[model samples]
Each structure stands twice: as C-alpha cells, then as structure tokens.
Target: MSDVMDYNSRLSDPASRKFETFSYLPAMDAASIKRQVEYLVKKGWNPAIEHIEPEYLMDSYWYMWKLPMFGETDVDRVLAEAKACHKANPNNHVRLVGYDNFKQSQGAAMVVYRGKTV
Candidate 1:
C-alpha cells in the first residue's frame, strides 16, 4: 500500500480556512449564485442577506441586510439585494440564508462573497 497523505494548503492558512458549507468548494460565479437563489425560492424558503467583517465571522450574529425577504419569490430581486449588500460592504463577508417558516429555522445558508484580503 502506498502511504500518501493529502495536504490542502488552504487548511493551514487561517485566512483561507472554510467558513460555511460551501466554503469548502471553489468560489461560485454569477450564474451559480443565481441558481442557489432560485433553489431557495423554489423551496419556499424566505431569503435573507447577512454580512460581517472577516474577523467577526466566528460571532453568532451577523448584521442583517435590511430585513428578511419574507414573501419574495423573484430570483432577480433576491440576487439584486445580495449584490447591493456586497457593494455596500465590500470588505465584509456576505452570505445568503434561507429561512424555513414551516420548520421555524434556517434551512440553508451559504457565503456568496469573500471579504477583501488585508
């Protein structure tokens, strides 16, 4: 048997460490991001945007971007809001979250933008 160990350079670097579930994967492009928003809407989950400075990512709560889009179904609108939040907070890490009303909890969450590296 060959003894080979897999080493990920990002794993050793704090700045490159994963934050959320999708963080482990490559960064998502515009079309991919839009698809995730579509999935959230299709699932009937309320979409919300949240952001925080990279240093404060470990904190439990993040600043909400406006308010949760309670009954929002338009994928464009959701993407627009997320874009706006990222534009406003260019240095902060922005994420999209899906709140499940039936389960009274968050059903999905993913980081859409990574903060600028210092």
Candidate 2:
C-alpha cells in the first residue's frame, strides 16, 4: 500500500455562467489577444473565447490556462504575456464561460485497506 496520495488541482467545480460579448469592447485589442492565443498555443492548448466568472475562478476564467505535465516550461513568462494581453484591452462584455472538471479515465483500481498512518 502506498501512503502518498496524489491530489490533482485540475479537478474543480463545474458550472455554467452568463456573460456579455466583450469582443468589440475597448478593453482588449486584436493584437494583444493574438499574443494570448499564441501563448496558449505554445502551451499545447487553443485559446477559447469565453467570459470570465470571476467569483469561483481567478480572473473569472475556467480552465483559462493549461500547463504541460512533465515538460519544463516557463510559467511566469507565459503568464506575464497573457496578462499583457488582458491588460492591453479591458472590455466588460458579459459572456458565459463554462467550467467542468472530471476524470477523463479510470486508470486503476482503488485498494482500500484498514491501516493507520505512521
């Protein structure tokens, strides 16, 4: 039996939200948004056009950014780039961004044993 338990932060509450389209708003511009898209692409993900919830999420984005598991990447650098994009334009067009986290695969069996932690 293994004592260490792995907790994945990826799993979070799923909820649907309502938002307005901030696309044309003067908050974020096209060039800056492109940078955000490029950053996501570099991280092996595509930039999704969604609204921020802001309540249960940081910056109201559900699954806003996905990072690689093993490969070494510059976290701060990428985040800074994204931040620049969001800041370059701040539009308050309400749009709904859905968020749902679940286990994609049942990898193995769970063995429950009556034991005490040492």
Candidate 3:
C-alpha cells in the first residue's frame, strides 16, 4: 500500500469515502505521549506539533509551527501543545513530532489524535 493508504488500511473501499484523516498508528493518550516525548527530549530531540485536515490528506506534509519546543525540558509543555492542537482540530489529524539537531525533518513521531476517539 502507498504511504497515504497506509494511514487507514482497514477501509474496505477507501475510494468511496469522501474524506478521511488518520494517524500512522493508533492514538496515544496524553500520558503515553508525554513519556515518549520525554524520552526523545532526553535523547536530544526537540518537540513540535503538526496537523492536517482530511481533505488535505493527499498532502503528505504535516503543518508545523515555526517555533518548536526548544530548550524546554518540561514534558507538560509538549503535552499541553499536543492537547490544544487536538482539541482545536478534533476532526483533523494531529501528531507529536521530534527533531534532532542534525535532522532536517522529524526524527520521531507519535499520533496524539486520530479523528474521533472511541
């Protein structure tokens, strides 16, 4: 399957759907996400948040703000931003992305939101 289709492989007929937004993996609760973020931080990776609308799912890029969480050792800040983004865009896709100093792109990512949570 293509990278886009990999977002939601369980769909029986994805082509028939109007629009869909999903994370690469199952959604992670706030605590679980915080733990991962903390781990990355300890490994010297900076945290950032991104989101994408379902209609724009064809766009592989995740929209990240210019200012990432830098020089911040607190996981609460990262958790807050992740929750805020997800709350603001409940129907959209949101993720916590981490970047290392040497990487031009996200080195690690976790899905904080995947549309409606069941």
Candidate 4:
C-alpha cells in the first residue's frame, strides 16, 4: 500500500536514524537515566558501560569502559561510572548495559550519551 511505503521511507530516512533500544524515544534526562539505573539494580542485573565513536555505532561490539560491576546494586555507583565513561570519551557514544547473570546475556541496553555528529 502507498501508506505503508510512505511510513517505511520515513523510518529509513538518515535524519531519523536510531541507535540502541531507547533511541526510539526522546532523549532521557538525568532523573530518567537514574531511574533506569535504579530499575537495573532492582532487577539484580549487573551494570556495565560501553562506548564507540559515532561512525562505529552500527558495530556489534563496543569498547567496554571497564569490567561489569558484578553484584553491584548501588544505583549511584552505576550512574557515576557511566558518567565517568562519557566524560572520558566525549566524542564517543556512551551506553549503559544491564547484564543478567542468571541468563548469561544482556537484559537491557541504552545509549546515555550521543557523540557529536558531523
């Protein structure tokens, strides 16, 4: 149908590009980011930080800031680490990931900081 074609074209437009899971939504604020961290803590998921240059956004692997914070339930600490990563890699896209140890996989991931676009 023409309507469906139009919608698909809009979604594929470069100006409307999306990154990670939360990229489809509006940019999140500090409070909202903290809330997400809180949820990860409450869910007992280990938090980790990763970053990559905007050009490598489509890459499957991102450079991990550090090891995953296993058994870390403190929301503030997780947020602090994410912020530190962003500060160190100002020109890279910083993302937060919640690793589910039991499942041995990532339970959640979202871009917290977007790098400068040329």
lDDT of 2 by residue, 10-84 (tens): 324222222233322344554554454344445443222222323433353433323322222444443453454
User: Relative to the unseen true structure, what is the C-alpha lDDT of residue 14 in candidate 1, on a scale of 0 to 100?
Assistant: 48
- Residue-wise lDDT of candidate 3 within 1-118, one digit each (tens)? 6664533333344333333222434455666777888888887888888887655545668787447888667888788887888778887777777888886766787666665422
Across 5-104, the per-residue lDDT of candidate 4 in tens digits comes to 3223133344355777687678999999999999988999999999998766777899999999998988898889998999999998899999998999
Which candidate, 1 or 4, has the higher TM-score? Answer: 1
Best by lDDT: 1
lDDT of 4 at 28: 98
Error of 2 at 77 (Å): 24
lDDT (C-alpha, whole model) for all candidates: 0.90, 0.31, 0.68, 0.85
Model 1 score (lDDT):
0.90
Which candidate tops TM-score? 1
What TM-scores do the predictions have?
Answer: 0.87, 0.24, 0.70, 0.86
Residue by residue across 1-118, what tens digits does model 1's lDDT show?
Answer: 9998543535335485568888867889999999999998999999999999887777899999999999999999999999999999999999999999999999999999888754
Residue 74 C-alpha lDDT in model 3: 86
Please tell me which model should have the higher TM-score, number 2 or number 3.
Answer: 3
Q: What is the lDDT of residue 92 in candidate 4?
A: 88
Q: Which ranking of candidates, highest lDDT first? A: 1, 4, 3, 2
Poorly placed runs, candidate 3 (over 4 Å):
1-26, 116-118
